[model samples]
Target: MAEDNPKSSVMKAGVDDAKWYWLAEGWAPGGHIREVDFDAQMRGIDPLFEGIKIVDCDTHFTEPADLWTSHAPAGMKDKMPHVRRIDGADQWFVGDKHFGSIGGNVIAKDRNKLLGRLAFQNYDQIDPGSYLVAPRLAQMDAMGVWAQICFQNGGVTQVGSLLGLGDEPLAVAITEIYNDACKERMDASGGRINGMGTLPYWDKDLMNQEMRRIADMGLKGITLPDRPERVDSSSAYVGPDGKVSPFWAEVFEICNDQGIPLNYHLNASLDANSAIWDNLGFDQKLPIHALLHHVGCAATLSNFMVSGILDTYPKLKIGLIESGMGWVPFWLEAMEHQLDEFRTRENRGLKLRPKEYFKQHFWVSYWFEDYAPKHMLEEIGVDRVMFETDYPHPTSLYPGVQDKLVETLGQHDYATRKRVLQDNAAELYNLEI
Candidate 1:
């Protein structure tokens, strides 16, 4: 009777038509929808980052396996950095010691796949952009990054490890080779990438000569290992006597005079005790080790703060690279508190409190951080904070860097965002863009 009725027939037809409509819309009976094209969706422009310039203060690149070998002086060819097949993998050899492997240097592409592994053994496995300047610029453009401050990968440590094993000529030659390669890349980048020169911290005369050479090369800054001793124990720049060693003072003065900031990257200190952590097993050791990575940087800063270095050279600018600014607030506060409780004219080399010196002389970089910028802006000061990507490293903000920055600094006004993202770094490094 219902089927025969005209009204009932019309209602049944409408319901049946709705089923076909939903099917065409890609919805199923279980409320499932067809797969989405996320990549295509991401192609849509993000209004938040529109027209915003981003200057990445920290990024790393792998040196070509032949960097030292190709550039070493004719007489120093035998002492150059080279790759040797050890067991089944490629190991980087510098003067008789196995410094590192080429594998883990460029992990940006297969990071998820090689999550727990330390280094990648060969160039075939790495992203070309990791070592090649042209491709790296293209990658930066795709990510909306305006510029980068580039640092060496394991090559710095490798040069350091060669210490006593090689003669001064070989050591200086190796340093020159690496610096030339960096300069060549920077020259090729059309101002988008600025290479920080590495100092031959072992010999005072060589270090001075290289510093002058780096300044002549028009490099923006110089990279100081968090622990110079890690590279060569006898040549440790900072020790029981403090960072005021004639070598350090001269280096600082040269940087200040040349207008190049002294840049300190994290994890330069490799403690002998770190080997003991292996007994804790990978799972337990990994997290704890990561937690302690910044300790050396803090110690380095403490030494500088108390040594009157900042007070001695007012124009000297120091950039703390790859070390997040989150810890800075508490670190400075603790330093200030200690200064207040224990201030003696003899021991207190600093005319100002640690925090005051920090505010005046230091620029700190932050990446993969959200809460620090928002909450500690006043303590850290917006002017002293700079943004970094730590690109191509394990902790880099690569594909979705814009989104992460927006999420972190969006709540602030455009001026603050602009300063943190670009203006501060530009001013610090004297970058045009």
Candidate 2:
């Protein structure tokens, strides 16, 4: 953490968190916890989900500041991803180059602040569960969730920035440490928290090696760059005229053969960083960014639907993480309609329709949408859908996950609810729960 982001006393026994910095007026996590009652909330939701171990297929683990530097050798320690307080914001840096602020926080002491909490001025103000494995599991337990597939929250492995530094070793170290940290967090969580792997995607050889390593280490899946050619226009994956060549074939094959799902979290890639307008205020841009992020996932789905990747590697599973499922039916309809109208040479070669491809290979996760869960689960394919709570991020389904569960999934039959909330993800990630 940065100098100003003081270390938390959360692990300190009986420390009285209500008196803690920036926690609520009477905040105590295990006790009263101000006005919060997770047990009561889960009790309300229990009949529908009594025996089910709900799988939150998409949540984020905010990386601790030492995630990289602690593992780096002494000489390279200062150069690995480390935080420094810059302009009153805790920003990550690699050898004085600014990565970005660790800006995913919008929770405090297990409380959701969508209406009251505006911004996290420093790391200390954020929830401990955001970065800690034990607390994350506790958070899941409190919310009536059994397991979570976690992604890197803070955009630390965007890779383009690491590649731009022209230091391949540093880039590799950053990626390796992130992947290593993913495995570490998974192990520490007793498999309740499965962190997805990342890759130094500009290099195909390195990417292939890391995928194998991830599979061997039992990391559930990997998040890919939607366009790896954009990482380095001169890399081997970059063909003539800066077009992407047959670079992603091995990735698809490995994922298909190994049964490793390719998760697209729709963050720091797929045009997500550019989704928000420059003029909007921080809070104003927050929601607009997330809404547009779902649109990016829609584009990703459309691309894969027509790209022939699914047809070629028919068994590969795709996860649209943190992407709500309400828009998918309409998007697929629009795509099928366009395919019918355009009948181009390329469109003629696409063996399956967009919706067919989606049903065959892709899986999506939804959070905080009532109509979709209640009325449209069948439309979204309950077998291919899962639940998530986004967890501590802005716009996350925090402080009311059980409420949301009861409101959205409560009406469904037991089997349907089990599939959406647990079985799909358990089969996908092979989580024991």
Per lDDT, the best of the predicted structures is 2
Please estimate how well model 2 matches the true structure, expressed as its whole-model Cα lDDT.
Answer: 0.71
Task: State the lDDT of candidate 2 residue by residue for 1-433, as single tens digits.
Answer: 0122133211221112111212221121222123445566534236568899888887778889778888995578877888887556666777767666664666665453534343364567677888888877777777888888887766567665666667888888888888888888888888888888988777778877877788889888888755453444333333454333466667767789988888888632344336556777544654665688788788778767766566678898888888888998999899988888887326447678887888888888888787888898888798988899887665677777877888888888889888888899987887787
| Tens digits of per-residue lDDT for model 1, 176-238 | 878888788877887888888888776677788888898888888888866554333434444
TM-score of candidate 1 relative to the true fold? 0.82
Q: lDDT (CA) for every model shown? A: 0.68, 0.71
Worst 10-residue lDDT window for candidate 2 reads 10-19
lDDT of 2 at 422: 86
RMSD (Cα, Å) of candidate 2?
A: 9.5
RMSD to the hidden true structure, all candidates? 19.8, 9.5
Q: What's the TM-score of every candidate structure? A: 0.82, 0.84
Highest TM-score: give the candidate number: 2
